[model samples]
Target: MKHTIIFLFVFVFLQKGGLLAQSDGDNFLNNSVKTEHFELLQEFLSIPNDANYPEQITENINWLSDKFNELEFNTAILETEALPLFFAEKLINENLPTVLFYMHFDGQPVDLSKWDQESPYNPVVKMKKGEGWEKVENPDFKNLKEDWRIFARSASDDKGPIAMFLSALQVLQSQGMSPKFNIKVILDSMEEKGSPVLAPAVADHKSVLASDYLVVFDGPMHDSGLPTLLYGVRGITRLRLEVFGPSKPQHSGHFGNYAPNPVFRTAELLASMKDENGKVIIPGFYDGIEIDENAKKIMEAVPDDERGIRKRAGFAKPEQVGGNYQESIQYPSLSVLGIQSGWVGKETRTIVPDKVIVEMDIRTVPETNSNRLIELVRNHIEGQGFTVLD
Candidate 1:
């Protein structure tokens, strides 16, 4: 009996020690919710940092800089030839690999009518049911489930992830689980504006951003509730292609047959770009787009229930072709995002606009390049007997 008890004690001791060792790796946060920390988040959410409001945006950047400084990080404000960029570093060793973490601080403009509370910035806490949210008076975090979410401008879209990452890091520091790689946190102010200046900024700061890997915490997960690890994103190229006929607007009534209606010509040009099944009708559009084994495997993992997807997107039918969510996103597409010419409003109706401006964008897949796609588009337009002007 004595020997059996001793053996049981030894087994228990080793089992418990093994559990602790495994848990030491996940030391970022204790699974406890501290409401006080949320107070600081709410306070930060109240500050306006609309990119259009440059002065207020600067103030917000300074506040974020102060936050890094408070966290004992070596913080610096870097410029990207456009808006200011904040780069904060916390290095444990000089020789360690670096992980560049990216996120944006700016948010979309506020629409007061859509807000639930009085103001989007004056966050209010209210309760009526089981789940809770912060009624962000600022209205940054839209699509909120409750008053616990602030709707100011960029709440969940980005600022929420930014806060979560930083807070997690802070907790990790508190727990003494040092980062394996050198850390670089970059906060951009113009991501919502199509990140026009970001690519150039990254190229210029290649040395400063030299890192083993980059972790971009943007966009959301799949509606199927699966934890996603995106390898790459589809690149976009936007251009305004115009077909000029005459010098100025002509009265369609005066020269119905003789004058070239640019609107009709524009319609014909766009119609030839895509088929009825929504596939890009351009020749060679699908060239070099062979689905690799890995991509096929990843896509096969996606759920294929029409009911579930419809319930999530709040629609009965899929948005694009190829029958599933994965195909719609994976394949390349050419879409005329916007088209404007002449007057369709209340005041104007008689004139045939001479110049038709069609703004189109093409989303490219991995095997394709944006420049080559642009070349294809320009070629297609010119081939259809239309004058091409960049």
Candidate 2:
């Protein structure tokens, strides 16, 4: 019996020693992995990711596949009518809950003439020096600084976060540990263009995308520098209104008083939609919103610094739509985004324009009925003695 107890004690001691050794080994590996950044972000940024160009988007897909594959993730290129979605998942444990992470890979198309750099795809690292940035042609651990920014398309907009996430996977791999939960990532390729195929893709790949929770990692930081959790986002819709005038372009001198300038008519129509203080004049447009006492208190408490904002914007006074900027957005707004009349600037012309086009975008909240808002705008326009065209 004494011999049997000795054997059991030896086995237990060895088991405990093994666990401690593994823990120490993992800590050492993790500490050393600080230098491993998964994949060089410069290479990812070097690939043009404009979803409008399929060739550019395809190259990004291949790169995403290779990087995720290195981490032993099951990668799939989910097809859609537009650009394909890059989906990667690592099922570490069947019993663990699944998490779906959403990020976009596409970037806004670059206008080379407008960009200061040779190519938008070629990222430049720079450090801030006073009001301007000093170029850092090449960066290494010795020279890299925290304040240095990467000037490239999609660098901060998304690819930066993606690079960080990939590095996190590498850190876990180095430590010989799996993710606490099953991980799935969906990298959208057409997010800049409003993600047209996203809804259809969701419907078609419902089973593939099933998860306990979804986390979207693309958005701006809170103004207060505090982390924020968003419950919902406002929906957007646009309307283009074109008002025809003369059959053809007429000389402004010849028809200055005789011709009814469509530009002026269009201007009047737009002006009628809103009051002088910038409130939407269309009846019932803001009916759904209720500014309760609690909401007023919250709005009043926020330190928005309206005077500072006005100073930066070079405005002595602001439109009295709301008490402050934060409260203003709570109500639906009508804005004439752009008004096109005759050519100006270097292309100045003395002729009246054939037609005037006004572009508008509406932000919808949960309380607002989109159909009712549309009807109200339509009724207001008709009430102003204007023709309604489909």
Reference-based lDDT, each prediction? 0.69, 0.75
Report model 1's TM-score to 2 decimal places: 0.77
TM-score to true structure, per model: 0.77, 0.80
RMSD of each: 8.8, 10.0
Candidate 1 lDDT, tens digit per residue, 289-374?
76677877777677756677677568765545454667677777887867878888686878778887877788888888888888
1-390 in candidate 2: lDDT tens per residue?
111222232222224334112333523432332323412667888999988899998999999999999999999999998888999999978888898999998999888887667788888777888867777765663334656777889887888768767765665566565555788999999988878899899899999999998988787544453445566666766677888889788998998787778999888998888887888878888887888888888878876677767875789887877777777878777766777877889999888778998888777888897777878888888898888887
Candidate 1 lowest-lDDT run of ten: 1-10
Regions more than 4 Å wrong, model 2: 1-39, 141-146, 295-326, 335-345
Instruction: List runs of model 1 lying over 4 Å from the truth.
Output: 1-31, 109-150, 174-177, 243-246, 249-259, 292-297, 304-316, 319-323, 342-350, 354-356
Clashing pairs in 2: none
